[model samples]
Target: MSPDLYTVIKQICEEKQIPEESVVSTVELALAAAYRKDFADKLQNIHVTLDAQTGNFRVFDMKLVLENVSARIKEEALKLARQKKKAALYMPEFHDHDDEKFNADGVDLNDDDKLIEEGKVLLKFNPRTQITISDAKKIYPDIKVGDEYKEELEVPGDFGRMAAQTAKQVIIQRIREAERSIVFNTYKNREGEMVSGVVQRVEGSVVIIDIGRVNAILPYREQMAGDEYRIGGRLKLVIARVEMTPKGPEVIVSRTHRDLVSKLFELEVPELESGTVEIKAVAREAGSRSKIAVVANEENIDPIGSCVGQRGARVNAVIDELHGEKIDIIEWSANDEKFIASALSPAKVDSVEILDRDERRAKVTVKAEQQSLAIGKGGQNVRLAAKLTLWKIDIVQSETNAVIEISDDEPGDDTENVSQ
Candidate 1:
């Protein structure tokens, strides 16, 4: 209970990593609270000061020196006069000595001689507080009265015991708020980037991830399909967005964002990172299929092969990161016909003729045997091709002999003359 307040404050500040000034303020407030417990609420108006050097604190009831004392002893009249006087004098610029012994002409002498007598006559009193000088010097031998000091008040042994339980609750609440802010800020600007995190827990389909210092919300909607999350698992994810709230920040994280695919490629493909190979566009069904169109800015580098790596090792690593999501890397072409042809890969085509490039529609004639492969199971292949090439493609069997008609407004134009 008689611990050195200065050392106690310093130790607390160091332990909590809080500034010394903040610890001083917290101690001052705690003493104010103890004073309120010991005295009436009116004493709440009393100011408590802390000895910064000695860490001793005390309370003082300050009053203004005024003339014309009333003897009525009617507390009601005294209260009214105090209220009116407080209003005029205690504006924004009110100071401690404003109410100290001043004459009717507003002159004051800095002498404590009128202390007891003046205490009765003053209609307006401004209470000020500070740690007692005796207590301050006990904590720090170098401290003295009239010298400003910050004092740490001891929370009573009983209160300390109770606070052990209460502090846990209070700290837990405060920490959650602080952590939310940390998480929010960390992920808010990482919308299109990948972040590594530790899995803290799982709630149903959602995973609560510790993305460094804060818990990022990994919703089921953003998780890769069929990926199971176990507690304490490490994850690499894309930050979806950060949301603000009254308490703190909320971060939404995703494994399924299209950027996740691109980011993985960036991590895996050295050529892409060096800017020799550029990922022109990416379309993903997420956890099912994804297609990326890449171009070689440097002519010597084969963009598709570079992304694929030797024997499909690089792209396979990306697929494993995505929990076995299928990836197709296609060469990007400036020619719409060539690009569309590549977009629908692994299927041989007879020929492709542009029905309307501006309208983003094209007709392709594939061998009857390649029709099923071009269309794919459940039309996934062509759908991905549309998204990848940014064009609408209609695959027709060459055996059907069906001609893809252009608008009648067009004059004689031979479709075969179109370049591949």
Candidate 2:
């Protein structure tokens, strides 16, 4: 009996979010495989078609016509016939009678060659697999060689349990393949963007988040150091990358990427979105502190004030999202000396001089008391300042008696004093 495929197609389309045409094609292919396996001969090429609207189905057998059998076709048919002959020769009934003779080897070589010749003749004259021009004319007066003929076959009353199982497996496999394609296209476009999701589960140190239709993985290395990953908690994540794997597409998300701060700022601040204030650069140590440089294109608008918002509300919102990660907003300047001085914020600088223009190196002088603040704890401030300004900074402390020079590469304890 014909199955009600229309309802099944609609259901699959809605559940899988796949196109109706794709589901219909998948069903047709599954039905064709089931029909061929259960009812058709091995050599018969069969096709199955289903009516999408009415749930009717039909099957066809394809046959090739040839003028004279080609050498390749003859060889293939001979090979198949020999395989069958070998199987029949090893049967118990035949083996019992000729066991000794056949086991002796090299006996009646002519008989073997005769058997091969008979098999070739039988295959060459077989009309179902191959037909000659004269034979074709009897069936179709205007038939030509090298043409294909298709014959419709009666639809089977029922496909057995095994065939039903095979069809179901095919449908499932096709659906998985379609799902992979959809997911790949969906997330591939979302790379380098921020998305919101709920924490689905935790596997060891990795956290899985349900971002709408697909799950994204946030590896331990990409997670914020102090953030708690509880199930059902909501998180805003950056889509670091999307990769295709043998199982399916994998989405890699991040919370500690430096760009995450930039994206968050873009989300909160409208001036950055409208391109009034441009973020020149961003330097971050995730879960700790970050420095961002912004320049205002309009003279009346203040870049720092806009990002900071009324009473520090906008920047504070971003800080709250980052779990109290400290952020320093600096005004960008084209002058290397001015920009370098501002990049080291909260630390008063006495002066900044360009040491090497070609090498992009600068010497910054600060008061002796501000040396520790300029260098920061573990030299993080100088490191981020250098990255934000794209310059190598050498901090020189101005004291009453001597000058102490400290390079960012050197440890905080390693300070060299220059005699006046």
Candidate 3:
């Protein structure tokens, strides 16, 4: 390779963070495609190798030996392929790498179950890269089925301008595709994990963030209420999902997902990270308040204390990240009644009765003075408690004994037994 070309490739590998081997292989494939487009026939199995150490080229016409297919079958397939109208049954011109067609079971091959049951090795032969056993025996007597037969071809001295242009296009396109794959995989594995990013720009309600590898988007639905995403401001976020668009991979980051709190706690508390303490459940109303339940695996460790930190340092950090949103950490209990009571924190439950075990319905009674505290502003407390426990909770004031339920679907509907 030329020193200039080597330097450029090295720079590209460093900047793109792509493997050198992948780039080199891509270059070789692009060169092969260009050579085929300019100098080879259609369906010709063309192979080209380029030496990195000392810029040298090798060209080959590669073919695979067909074990059971005969020349007569090849003739029939070619004939059918030429007849355009009758080609669907033979799946003519439907070529993968070898430009060959396979018809298994001849049933509606679309049905996966039937195809797997009755399917067998069936080939509509292509004469280009596949050679019959008899023809291969004549060329090389000891050649075996499924073995590659390579014929050395003379290398051309120079490629035309059009072919060179095609190679450049292929190299650009392939490198872009590789980069997209890398981004998709990197963010896909990070779903439900915390990531920090700088606000790049805002497109209406959607805020775009620059997160090192890719530009992740925080859509309107995932944004916390009253949260400002000012340009160049840094924010902690969790990746909700990664999807591939026609343009590229779209990394959907969220600040409102319940997992965001779990991840934040994990970062703040070493006990949570080390498995001494775990977050049992979390229910969040973004930018307002959240309730989380914690459990301890070790007897000596206090899960609540670990999450709360010394004088509220750990949870304060999470609250700061959430833009002053309130968080209530409660001890998780195994007893259903106790857990339901604890789910409604700060209310001082008088009693908890499982009204319907099958439907996960519970009745929580509190003193008349504590009724508003249990319901919270616009019934947010009871709403989050019901969500956190995955139970339909009915709040009853002991003095009046009137049951009231918070409807999470229709916000502000604190109707009696409306049920979320």
Candidate 4:
């Protein structure tokens, strides 16, 4: 009778969230290995069947009967026999003969004559590899060569310590493999989607997040600027990618990704979720500022108004998720000039001229009073606008209908050329 393992199998299935069938199969395989180790030689074809409900198992040894044994089987049997002989020679009982007849190295003068005789019989036929037709008749009266025979073997109620340790290793390996599969399937589907998790711990510059099913890695570069990552703090991040490593599946998540803003908007705005509104592009500096271009597919929908919600409720919620980051929701345009004009928002533009279309350079004319706003603090606004529009922008000041070209090539130093 086998030990009752039904309770242990049930507990493993529940705790690991693995299917009962998978757990049972793993346990069966481990038990088979343990039985082979404890009751049969390595070369024996041993199989074990387990009754999952009762936890009782039976073992069988299968062998093939051949009239003439194959060379491969003959070689393998001889190799096994030699290994067993070498092990037996090292035993104390084998060395118990008179020490006077042996040299200092424990080599007996008479053992040399015995070894010469034993080597000749080393390659003799082994019963485990092949049973003669004459011997098969003793076990089964009608048995013939080329027939397979299976013998049920009696096993001890408990496995030895070594066999038990082998079973434990097999079980642990199977569980790890199952866990890796589960994590890969779970996180692979969630790529490019938002996920909620808690800060589990920090290692060096990487933060490990507990995302319900598995732990995700948030590298230092992916962390939000100036955000505190205290243990147990809740975070909403985007799944940047899912990778399979030798150790296991690794989920790479990001809080600094621009798609994080898009995902947050999807969560906050019904239009985005319903496919009525689509995001064309997003330029973000995480924990600081972001600009998104949106267009409405339905004529009845006002994409900007929908995103802003009634009295800025929707945008505020998204902003709060990002830790008070500034967002500019602008209407996307098919016309490059109109899009560029809209991209430089919160500042009134007099006109926009395409300086070099092939080079993607543009010149914007703003009122002298609005020049500082267009250029923004440390040119951050203009830089973000340029990035969002995918254009090289040069802000020119207009005073008294006269344009003064300002070159932004030298950062932090404004070089102006007067033009009429």
Candidate 5:
């Protein structure tokens, strides 16, 4: 209402990141609601205007220019009085004349006359029902009945301290909701990407992570097995899934996915990321064991050795992030026999017999001393190898006696020259 209104609106627009036009529109709606409570019922055509230069605002009630006003009112009355058609004479009294004003004898006046009188009555108003106008000239000469009024909106005085307090509370609540919604939408589309979040709280096996804006739930199933999350600790996780619910979007992030291992390698192993070396496969038993296979496109570059780095420095950093998880880096090979043998590392394979090429099933025979090493501790090694090669593997000791009845189509080795 005062010059300060412009400043107030502009400041709110900038602070909220809401457009200036939107602030004006919101203020107009609020004024319209106030006017409706204090003024008229035919508010459909009400309009609000704000002066850009001075921030002066005005409310105007508008009505269509009817060719026959009396007829229109009669039509409106009939539409509302349809039930009285059978008893027209006994129907409730309906008047086209105005009801807000009356003569001294209590006879209602015409609509136009009543409007003028009510306007005057409304202008001389109270705190909850009125606004002020300032005129420097007339001893106050700038004032007029229909001219735009001015007032400084003092939140505590104009609205009573309690009402102003309530408004402050409302604004704070709305802001919190807006911030939550912004964060939810921002992270909802981040499926399959890495995110850094702080551990806000841990309940049972679930950790509530605060990702700067909103809290995201990290379920136990999505976390690396046996991973211990402490409050206020920072974590880097990959968004695995997003579920839209009535409240908002629920994002499931993980540190245990096979892709997570690949991503970590991509971050730590520059050779694997640069296309000189490509990651072929990643098999992870999170917090326990992981196997990654890589291939070098350039000659003389050993992909496995490069990823391991000097004295295992490069891969060690990644393994430390997984809470001391063990990592096995192996060379990627297109040859299934070589790949399967490479996957089952720390053990030498005597032979790898491809039993079913279509099924990708193979039997890996290792010497007696290498049997325990080939299978690894509790079979973790062989399991990871199977996953890395994407093959079904059967491990057998080389000395194990077995009889194989080969079909006649299978050729036998020729030893006639050696015998002679």
Candidate 6:
């Protein structure tokens, strides 16, 4: 190999953000595979090492040092080998996990030489890979069982056209595998955090966004109402899930997640990170409205005011990010009654009567004029308040003594309230 080969390997490592050791190991494996593809018939412990400075290859045929093998253990191995043949014809789902670990002949992996079962050592005899301790002492003076014994082999120059193509395919396959691992780990740690992305395209109901290293999928359900996903448009999304699929890493992002509200606040308000003010709970209806409850650790600091910023600059920044969605920032109280009343903001509550403490149900009586405000446009206010407090709320009119209905999920819901 020319010295320029090292320069090419360095360029690949820098571009892919992969470690130098990993890339060099991949090259060595490729060389060993190419040599085996043309010459070797059976599996052998082939180890290939590349010199970084000179770009040279050194090949070795390695064997495991085994103490002994019993005839019973050998019979068990033969039985299992027959079972594998039966599986190829009939049983398809007999094995689920990958056989990569068990295939240690040419594949470099971490495992002991012997298979130990129930305090007994089970050894499978393979003359090609394993050597007996008494026979091994003839070749070497001091060699212990369970240790590896290696003999240097000549590096072959010429493999057929097919074998050379196989080596190229292996390099490409391993590079792709390494990239998938890097992208999956990088975004999995950022779950529930906001990320900046550009709209790549809309595939039916799902919108794909280019987020730095990878593309994130924003499903139709996660997209906010009235939100436009034009191509090349910029967006701020929260990572909801990161999973590996047969193809590659799947990053699911959301605009309608409740955490988006609190995450946005953390960006605009520096106090949230200081331990001075803390956000207690967030209940969001995504595009239309959101309710956030916050508490102050110190008596001198006002949590809601701190979030609202000077003349509402802080909260306004969050609202702009949400595409002008309305926000209700209320002070969190330890008392359930006071907290429940506060959750239904812009609605004056005359009294809060805990109907069933065990059930976490409450009856809130508001002034006759404030009833409409409390119920919002078709009970949206009461519904969001219910979600924020995690309590079932009933809106009652102080004057008419009539109970109003509410729905927890549906918007514009006018269901009747049974509570008195």
Would you estimate the TM-scores of all the predictions? 0.58, 0.75, 0.85, 0.70, 0.59, 0.83
Writing each residue's lDDT as its tens digit, candidate 5 over 295-391 gives 8889999888888889998888788788888988888787889988998997898888899988777888888898888877877788777767767
Query: How far in Å is the alpha carbon of 230 misplaced in model 3?
Result: 1.6
In the range 1-420, model 6's lDDT, one tens digit per residue, is: 667778988898889988888788777777767766665524345567898667888876666788766555545444443332111110123221112124435432222233433212222454445566876778886999977777677766776798678778877888888889999999999897899899999999999999999999999988998899899999888999999999999999999888888889999998998878888888777788888889988889989999999999999999998999999999888899999899999899999998888877889999989999998885778998887777888889998888975535445211221111
Residue-pair clash count for candidate 1? 20
Candidate 3: give the clashing pairs.
1-55
- Stretches off by above 4 angstroms in model 1 are 1-182, 401-420
Whole-model alpha-carbon lDDT for candidate 6: 0.76
Give the Å error, residue 240, model 1: 1.4
Top-down TM-score ranking: 3, 6, 2, 4, 5, 1
Best by lDDT: 3
Tens digit of per-residue lDDT, candidate 4, span 1-420: 345688888888889988888787777667767776667653455556788878888776555565644455446445644454111101123221211122324333234344334442222344433455665677787877777655677878789899899889988999889878987998899898899999999999999999888899999989887788899999999898999999899999999887888889999998999989988878777888888889999898899999999999999999998989999989888788898889889888989999998887888899989888887776767766776777788788776544433333434211121110
Query: 1 or 5: which has the higher TM-score?
Result: 5
lDDT of 1 by residue, 153-241 (tens): 33333444443444345444544444455456656766667889888888887789988656888997787778878888888898888
- Extract clashing residue pairs from model 2: none
286-402: candidate 2 lDDT, tens digit per residue: 898888999888879999999999999999999999999999999988888999999999899999999899887888898989888998998889877887776788888777524
lDDT: the better of candidates 5 and 6:
6
Candidate 2 overall lDDT versus native: 0.75
10 residues in a row with least lDDT, candidate 1:
411-420
